[model samples]
Target: MFTPVRRRGTEILDDPNADAALSLRSLRDIALANRFFGGKRAVVREVATLLRRHSGGNEPVSLLDIGTGLGDIPAAAARMAGRRGLVMRTIGLERAPMLAAAAATRCTDALAADAMHLPFADRSIDIITISQVLHHFEDAEASQLLQECTRVARMGVVVGDLRRSWLAVAGLWSSSYLLGFHPVSRHDGMLSVLRGYTEPELRSLIERATGCHAGVTHRLGFRITAVWSPRYRRA
Candidate 1:
């Protein structure tokens, strides 16, 4: 067992040429973690708020979920929207073809697309979500990614990721074993905690990237979520 330092480090999943089975296994574990913990719940709550605000309309809202590995978050949001009487059309984007294929099973509208270069027009999507994916990028790329997210979203964007803390690392380590996560999952989970950002750090990064006032809130299970609506209208 290797002890991860309290610093950002690349996980094997970051590699484009990694093993497919390992990557899918890790994604499954991640989906389970988000489901049991507050990852999926946090995004669902934010989506619920937006749904309520955009209610009283027959038109279905379009939600584009970026880096939707197993499509758990968007799938959950779509299901929740149905229960709340809000019509939603959920779409998931995954850069990896295999990931996109797997996500398509969970979300019918999944596509293979890059987060940095979204295919949608400006302000085309009602809502956009990026879950547990930000920590993989450096400062500059993260900022660019946020800008892209802001560009496509007409209403708001939801970002959920791990919060950097020793407690979080230990919790992930213990829970991975308890929950029967894969070996790669365990390693990547711990590394993700180490690579995570604090609330303030995330806020600054998002604000810089999107050029909008955004607040990052720390939630249960050492997760941090930011819900930001662009203040300025798209040109």
Candidate 2:
């Protein structure tokens, strides 16, 4: 329920080593340090439930989790999809080699690749998800990535990310110290808040990029979640 801001071009922030450092930390601390994991779990669960309900029975589902830092959500999706006799074929894509290696240990398949250029063929994936990852891209790249997600996904795309607000900033700052996260985690967490897009802004970008409107909603009070499908497809 956030309004769109005036569109403006911005520089993309690159932190190639950020995910690598996080991977080196204690897994427990990494999970606790990032508040979005819990919210992302809920969102993924809800989406899985919806997909199952819509599919009318359990069927194999392929999921491409872009920017899957630690493969948590993809792993969760695999479990959820498994209940319906659905083979959860998941490919976790990460830019950092260390994170990709860590993710491979967590999930069966992991690939190191750029978000802007996914290795999958068009309409090859059932679902494409980006959790707490899109804000790392600038406006233009974010739009392009959205298009790529749509191109690669046959069913739908789900985005789970923080909603930029002063309250969010304050919460992140307090929790960073409380969780004893690494210095880079705390610093990047705060900066990510500042860089995050409101729900409307995300919707506008999706609409402009895909020439199709998208639905945006807030999740877990402070996270912005969006779901978009191709114009020919319904979600």
Candidate 3:
């Protein structure tokens, strides 16, 4: 069972040490495997679906992906947008300089920046994505980061992450023992579940932090996702 931490009257989970746990080599390998197996692809597809529905298949979309470790999500978005002759400019942000450097080699447009204090101007980006990244922040920091995500994004924000449940925990354990995953990956996966947020909890956090009405939903079989838009029209 996962213990929840309460912050500002909301039950927030703990933070996971996934970035510290996974080595660069292992991170890269896992990213590659995820791309090959459509793990990241599914995430991008959902984002694309949201974009098409909300933007009415608009051209020339811009995206900012937060905590984009290996740039897989942005890269996939770039590819999908390219099919429509829409110029997709994606900027991936990571905290680790080494991880940012590695992603730059793969993405050529990634930046090293803090999520709590993003370097971008206000309302400059069409979409912001946080995929499997929020579990690393404490409740207060995560709330602040979500506020920043809302501040910078012009259209909306999309968050995709693991759901904290017994099934997820059991799957991680089984994968660790049977699938020959790296020790760090196994340990971190379990820790991530413990640190993950439930649907109502995340919705409450976003609404309270950003002061924006948002909708939360589930996707990809076992992941929780949310989308938030500005409360008022922005000039």
Candidate 4:
């Protein structure tokens, strides 16, 4: 049994060429974890907030979900948007082909694309989101990824990820055990928390990398969200 350590490193799920079966199992476990541990709720909240703030709750918006896993978050947000009478056209991007194929089953549009080199025009996307993906990269790579996200997003960018802390480690470990998560899922989940960032750390990196000031929040369930956009409203 592997214990969650404070050491910073990459997880098996971070690899583009990770075993397909294991990756799918790991991704499903992640979706389950997000369902119970505030990952989906956190990103949904930000998406709704941005919609209300920037669109006055009625305008149609195009969303690009980066690192989308099974397109869960985008699908959830789309349902929320529909209820609010807002038209949200969503496209999901994944680096792993297997993951992209899985996402296609849930999302109308799913493509395999690298985060650092997005194949989109500047300011072409209305809203961009990257959920639980940043911790896989170093500070420099994370910064570069954010820069690409910011460049393509016209309205704003939302980043929802784990917060590095002992409580987070313990919480995920216990939750995974209780849920009977696969061994690979358990190992990678622990590593994710260990590799996650604090609010200030993410905020500083976003600002330094993109010259865009981001609002970093410590949410419930040991989640950290960093949002930034020229059109965002501060409250």
Candidate 5:
């Protein structure tokens, strides 16, 4: 049996020429997986913590989620902040126009844009969160994406991604089948996990990108999270 290598492979949804309806279904399936698995909880947990620590001021907090898929995760995080009396302005950014349209209803704002060159000015948003979007790129592009996140995020950035391991890949593949995920999504997810980062690799990548240490931790269901502030500098 051939072991899956860490090299990146293109997911069907990543292709610009992918069928519209298929892509939408694939996105929906991915969102469903996040709900059942620990992906949603991991991101909301980190974003909620960041919001609490920085949301003391009366001003509304701003949050931008790159590759916001269906926009459900940030919507949930925003509601959580509302419960604490902090108004959260959620921005959903997606490269796909169709996905952006669906996300707009769930967020304070939504736009179709590339994450590599964010439309917002530097350090403009209060918080930035990216989930399961990095693995689509190579190390250089991934590092650059992190720089963009740190550049735009004023308060902090939270990253939620998969942990690369054959065991994890197998678990998700089986779970996806039992959950009746779109066939394209199951294949795409397998590639995503193969492209995922280990704990130390993700930490080192963030440190290299931001020139500051990050808090990287493992969550349930092969998820890993990294949180860091752009203001922090290494002594």
Candidate 6:
């Protein structure tokens, strides 16, 4: 019962061809979920700490947030780094042009490209973050994405995703309705919970992909963050 559910379909916002206005609305709901829930905190906290430890000085570090919905997570990460007197150059990458354009408002740069095949050179970026996105893929694709992250990141990678739970599912069901989330948003949000991974599942996946034993932690809002340096010995 603790394992992630095998979802048969995709989330509403996952569609690259979705309607512009509806997609934006769905993204807004997701951004709010990241805020009110533990998504944003889970990612930014781990990433900021990674930046501080890996950074050599006050020189700017680069961050590329994959599948960045509205770029709020990366923006929040940058602010967290700023508080520590560190600089992070954030880039949001979305498969959809519309999302890339929209996220550019907050991120320093936004890219519309295929995530499985990143356009960056090896270890070119200081940090890479993927929040609430890895569960959308199956085992092979998920590992491929992690491998890509390891290939591009000079310092480390932070992966924040939902921690599968019945309580979270039930809570989101009522809360989404109470907050008047759009039907698509409500449906997708609940479905996302069902697709979330347990701590073991996530840890094993990362280890299998990048050969790094990641540090996994649970967050307040039924979230889990897995952080690891790209330069690490295999478990």
Query: TM-score of every model?
Result: 0.94, 0.84, 0.81, 0.92, 0.95, 0.95
For model 5, how does the per-residue alpha-carbon lDDT over 1-235 read when each residue is reduced to its tens digit? 3445686678878888889889888878878888988898999999878876784578999999999988988898898998988888999999978889988988999999889999989889999999999888888898899999999999999999998889888998899889998888999999899989888889998998779789999999889999999999577
Q: Write the per-residue lDDT of candidate 6 for residues 57-93, one digit (tens) a residue.
A: 7579899999998999999998988888777799999
lDDT of 1 by residue, 1-235 (tens): 4434447678978999999999889888999999898999998888777676684488888899998989999889989988877677889898888889999877759899889999999989999999999999988999889999999898889899988888788888998899999988898888889998787788888887777877678889989998888755324
The lDDT, on a scale of 0 to 1, for candidate 6 is 0.89
Off by over 4 Å in 4: 1-6, 56-59, 230-235
Q: Candidate 4's C-alpha lDDT?
A: 0.85
Q: Which 10 consecutive positions of candidate 5 have the poorest summed lDDT?
A: 1-10
lDDT of 2 by residue, 1-235 (tens): 3433423333222544435455456333435643443655645855674475346355567888887767777887887777766777788887777768877865668988878898889988888888777887777898899989989988888887777777776887887777787776666666767777777788887788887667788766467788866745423
Model 2 root mean square deviation, Cα atoms: 3.8
Model 2, C-alpha of 191: deviation from truth (Å): 1.0
Error of 1 at 53 (Å): 2.4
* Model 6 misplaced stretches (Cα beyond 4 Å): 1-6
- What TM-score would you give candidate 1 relative to the actual structure? 0.94
Q: List the residue pairs that clash in candidate 5.
A: none
Q: Is candidate 1 or candidate 6 better by lDDT?
A: 6
Question: Among these predicted structures, which one has the highest lDDT?
Answer: 6
The superposed Cα distance between candidate 5 and the true structure at residue 177, in angstroms, equals: 1.8
Question: Model 2 scores what on Cα lDDT?
Answer: 0.71
Taken over the whole model, the C-alpha lDDT of each candidate is 0.86, 0.71, 0.71, 0.85, 0.88, 0.89
